[model samples]
Target: MACKERSKGDSRDGDDTWRNTSLAAAPASRELGKAWILKRLVHHAPAIFHSFDFPAFELGNAFEDINVQFTEHGYILVGRSQYEAAEGPAALAPTFAAFKDNLCSVLVVNGLEPVPHETVVESSKTATLHRMKTWRGEGVNLLCGAVMEPTRGILVAQQIADDDRWTYSATSTQRDRMLWFERVYLPCGRKCVARMLLVRRPTGVATSPCAPHWKPRRRGIAATPSSLHRNRLQRRGRDSREDGMLVRVRGKILLY
Candidate 1:
């Protein structure tokens, strides 16, 4: 079963864009019935956010038997023939959940730090709106979304590159939506690199650890992302190395 964090919200169109979408093969966990099903749910944003300092906690392991719902882009995305989710979302949860949950701990992010395994996301009464699912080959950018209160641009966008690394980025949009981008990216057995661009409102700019600069976008202008100056090629390249690097910025680690 694919673990989905759904919250109450009015449905809206798909926030980001997806290309080369394909569902992944069911995991072996589903066949054995080892899945995390919803037990108790809170429809409101956790108060932890008001004072979250990268606090770590478990997402209740009281897996119960319930009618788990699988939704995409705010609605149920029915599978086409062979791509069907025969056992419902739970069956695919382990595969997608494993791939997504592992990203935070595996990758060394800048500016903001990812909670231990912040798999259970937090979205205003719209957590469900933040999720997205788009499979590009075996790589999946399963997690993406932000609150619509302080809008930005496109809500979500992900790409699994040929070089084994994956990039998942999102922007706040005008529309209030419930979106889930689920396309887990597997780095095989190689050391993988995941760079999550964390942001809150449109003006919620996180400094690229290397460059402590913040320039919010105006109208249609694009905010400049952190770059590696040619002079610091070898010196700055350590950010993407195996053991993570420290990013000096105080901000929320937005999902990617």
Candidate 2:
């Protein structure tokens, strides 16, 4: 479960580790090739930016479809589609079935470099209300709507104001899920841009790589494997159990 080594042009961060998305859907082995994901945790992506900037991290060179997973307590990066530009039906991004029939989800993280962003407790609030009442394999109550950001990678978003009523309500944690906006900041950046967030394409995963793969090489992990993804879960795993997807510029992540 480790295949992150892109070269040919080389960007900078050499050995940008790779070994995620396991427990089945296997592949990778040219020495860990690249490009093989399976309906990442069922599915939950499709534009829905509402905010997070730079034209959504410039779609980090068209995502490139990725997958990652690390467990013991934390790690999950899953990004999808847009493969370097287009291939068919404009590469599936009409907001992928209207945010999976209006269940909405988007997550971004990183506040203190490897550890400190409130200890990455599944984005807090009792682990996002026990992952909105668990069971996303289809339904435990369909994750109403969310757009959580953990911190540090230049997520300015949230500038809605005509009178600002972008609320669909539901917040005791998971009342069929509809939180849409929850932010907590404190990261400037130099080496921990901790990128990832460009979303869309959810018919139950199998794609959306942690972005930043223009092929000139250099970015691995979300866009870095998403700008060098931040799905990093070391909070309690002691070493690294694996649970990641890799972010880019837009939004949407599913952790474990």
Candidate 3:
């Protein structure tokens, strides 16, 4: 009987060892994927900008709550908000909640770059293409929308533009939590005069960092560090094993 009990104990220890080993290996893979995503965003942003007419523009010195302009080329508008700079990731949840609340008629569009004129007028019209059709011919106005990924901490928005010809391309660099830099592009005869630049904040953290920030929250407020960390994992599409790892990490932190 004693021998059987010992055997059961050994089996339990072996299972625990395997489980722990698996959990330990997962974070490395997740980190690799995160790095890959950042690299891809960086790689693609320049190609999108190369097609812009005026690649650089001097940003106006005055910071306004909202700036709106109507021109023959298109419309231009930018909105700014102030936040307490020291909160880091803690600020993302509330900020993103506000962002999501404002997305009323917006649909998830593909790629954050200037849509080619031909592509916009394509015959077999994708949903985005179909939407483009409504903007074509005669006096078309600027199209406005928000691309949000609450899970990934990414929110790419266009408040106003000169015309419907321009689109935005984004890259995620993990420096700070909410830094952004934007450059205004003057119109170059309906060929998409895009305002392009690395969005920067006062503190220099470029945030809204990934596509997962758009995932709808699964109830409960994310106010604590554990909850924020959990929300991040959910954004990254964490599996049960990863979830367990987080719980263990939280437990360790609590014990310490």
For model 1, residues 1-90, the per-residue Cα lDDT tens digits are: 121222236131131122222222244432121111010011112221111111111221111111111112111111100111223323
Off by over 4 Å in 2: 1-51, 55-83, 90-95, 98-132, 135-233, 238-256
Model 3 compared with the native: what TM-score? 0.21
Number of clashing residue pairs, candidate 3: 25
Instruction: List model 3 lDDT by residue over 1-256, tens digit each.
Output: 0001123344333422211101112545633433333333333333323321122323222321322222222212222332212333444456544433332222212112233343222111101111221121211111111222322233332211121232321122111111122222223321211132222111121122221112211121112234444455445343332222133333432332
How would the candidate models be sorted by lDDT, starting from the highest? 3, 2, 1
C-alpha root-mean-square deviation, candidate 1:
21.2
What TM-score does candidate 1 reach?
Answer: 0.21
Arrange candidates, best TM-score first.
Answer: 2, 1, 3
TM-score of each: 0.21, 0.21, 0.21
lDDT of each: 0.22, 0.24, 0.25
Q: Which 10-residue span in candidate 2 carries the lowest summed lDDT?
A: 156-165
